[model samples]
Target: MTEDFVNGAAVQALLDRASGLDAEGGDGRLKAIVRELAEAVMRTIVRHDVSESEFWAAIQYFQEGAAEFGLIVPGVGLEHFMDLLMDARDAEAGRTGGTPRTIEGPLYVAGAPLVEGDVNLSDDPDDTGTLYMSGVIRGPGGEPVEGAILHVWHANSQGWYSHFDPTGEQTPFNNRRRIRIGSDGRYSFHSKMPNGYSVPPGGATDRLMRALGRHGNRPAHVHFFVEAPGYRTLTTQINFGDDPFAADDFAFATREGLLPVPNRQGDAATIVFDFELQKAGASTEEGFSLRARAAV
Candidate 1:
């Protein structure tokens, strides 16, 4: 009798049986991906000799963290990974010369007050360090992109985002707004410099970070989602150049050419960052998934 070999080859063969109905109308990609991932996971488990107890514990850990899944993606770099994949595809297809796109994280709300060229975003009375940030939205060749919408939001000094915090509901949209680009493609806003963010202490995210010897902190940064006619929507963030975690962001989202040094002008610190957008080419509908959109 042959000795049993419990490596992934045997497990994968067993799993592949479920993919037998290849002619069932659907493209075979679904079963193919499932089989591939299942095999890889089995390999990792066997290679590491993960015990059944450890696997079940991991499952329970994930279940507990499901509510805060949005926060975990950026923390673990999945959000950034997706952005990199999109960027690579765009570059391979000849899409270039746009402000680098970054992760959107999970806190974006659809309806924000639309303001004109410039407005004050911070509502906290104690926020004494004002930030006067402005920028221009232009096309690939620097042509003005009038009427572009800049949906912006950022964490407050205490690292809590408006609307997500319990008290934040009282002033639902504070520190978050949608600004329309002016005729000259200029948009500006005054707010306090947002402080950095960290994972909830003692939560599922924190547990994993601790196990991996990693810290769950993001550098101080602001989020922007720019959309306009004839342009691909741009999602990106700008980080403070001097933040200790600016280069060591847990999300791995910090990008070169995006870190801006704040210049002090009297009471306010100003950072200028202009955005250049790529022209919309063929529709990116092929790789689009509604479920994935809902996840973000």
Candidate 2:
């Protein structure tokens, strides 16, 4: 039998005992993390007088949130938070100066078809005006990095990704392709500008956003995964400057210097954005996603 706890400190003590929070006694890392979280929750409960029903309701909300991990992580700005943490680490390690890093929203699929030079990113014959994006990939010192591969993908005119949308299963990887830079370090592609995407309706993410009085709409953008030998891999996206939702991205992944202004050329448009890569360390693998290290 245990004494009934009425005070905050007593409540914390009870949690410690129940969760094996004593550092010298509890050995597992996961156990320690859970104990710390439990202690914090206990304090919050005491401070806010949270009722048992409210606590359980919050748990259920998280359970629902888990079903749509992709939408929630970006909608709630966790993906952007991860990028901020990486920027801080890079500053600390004196590893600065490269194209701004952005979040790779959980929609990337590996093994898109590879092509030499440029490949058409949009296959729909009914697509709107063509967008021709051309740029050079250079190293830290502005020298061309030959043979760099740029994996490019984006939503369709209807703001739906290829593999994820049921209607697109026939031509999965539509609007997705990889272009290898030539000796001139230049790569270009033709595609229709992708429309902005909103969180899927009737999902948990949409429900939460509605309850919070927020819109879950991202700006028009294109994703790129740039990789080359002896250079750090980059996963980022570029936002269209003229997009109405550019300043109000739900994912909060937009950054300065990454927005591109379009130049209309008669029937088509062009956007030029150069990418600079950082040299990799001796043991760093080619095309390593920095997010892997941020978790550690």
- The 0-to-1 C-alpha lDDT of every candidate, in the order given, reads 0.78, 0.81
lDDT for each residue of candidate 2 in 225-292, tens digit (9 for 90 to 100) = 89998888887999988888898888887898788977877757789999998888754647555442
Q: Estimate each model's TM-score.
A: 0.89, 0.86
State the lDDT of candidate 1 residue by residue for 9-104, as single tens digits.
Answer: 655468767665334666577888877777677667777788999999888988989977887877778888988899899789887788998877
- Give the count of colliding residue pairs in each prediction: 0, 0
lDDT of 1 at 135: 80
Residue pairs whose backbone atoms clash in candidate 1: none
Q: Which stretches of candidate 1 lie over 4 Å from their true place?
A: 1-10, 17-27, 167-170, 265-267, 283-296
